[model samples]
Target: MTLVNTMEYNKDDLLDKVQEDAENLFRSGTYFCSEAVLQTINELLGKPYDENIVKLASGFPIGMGKAQCLCGAVSGGQMGLGIVYGRVEGEPMKDKMFDVSKKLHDYIIDEYKSTCCRVITRKWQGDDFKSPERKEHCITITGMVARWVANELIEDNKIQVGR
Candidate 1:
């Protein structure tokens, strides 16, 4: 559904709704890790998940595969936060973006209990050789991270919460 139509909120209620929507997005997907995150951001922000955001975030999974640092899902969550609260030139509200991003990151880390990619992927990591389990794990983790970030943003009053 379009966020504008689906969203109903006063200033106090937006975050909870956004977090709920984010969790719903994650649970609904079997795959679509990156796309689902982008979609969640759009829904939470009451914007559209257009091609540009997708293209910019396309490199996330590749980065995860190469860097082997944080999980791609977590990266996707960070990217979504950046997209919604990112700083821009001449924007008087730029400082808020950093605080918001930090809060989101901290919340995800706390919720997941670990930020290490290997740790997060440990459950699905195996020598199966071409098993789809790894991808599924990544997708699930992505959803979790998305939910946490959405929750933080909402709770922190960084975004408009919806009913």
Candidate 2:
């Protein structure tokens, strides 16, 4: 049996599936941006981790409950990283977790030009919570983050690429 890694699978197809799943979740309107991203990752991983983790991500949407802080998608991606690499005891994996988090954060910033929800949603939502544009913007962010996080997980061997 071969263990999967970055070079062992079709990375693009995996990313595409992540993106598609996230978009479907977004359109379902059953989850917030952050919840959607994290939930999708959980689903793709066959729920190896506690499925209840999805509830933990509920408060992250709309910039941490509309406080306009960190982008929910970014937060969700970091949370997904934690699901795979987070240490439950000792401090051995601490550095790895932080490193992966920073990488995910950088990826978000590079793609979205910012990691703040207020900034990214400014044009789409401004001060209007019910703006229709917010959904599309959040959906795009959710898909992008899901794909990036999945790639990171696969490359790090936290998730088997072909599984």
**How much lDDT does each candidate structure score?**
0.59, 0.79
What TM-score, to 2 decimals, does candidate 1 have?
A: 0.66
Candidate 2's residue-wise lDDT over 1-163, tens digit each? 0112333457787788788778778778877889888888877676766667888999999899989889888888888878777877765777888898998888878887889988888786554657666777788889999998888777777666542
TM-scores of all candidate predictions against the true structure? 0.66, 0.86
lDDT of 1 by residue, 1-163 (tens): 2465334565434444444454455456422455566667666666645645655555555235545566556667777877767756886666767776676567657866666666666665564313467655655566566666666666666565444
Q: Could you tell me which 10 consecutive residues in candidate 1 have the lowest summed lDDT?
A: 11-20
User: What lDDT is reached at residue 2 by model 2?
Assistant: 12
Return the number of clashes found in candidate 1: 5
RMSD to the true structure for each prediction, in A, is 4.2, 4.1
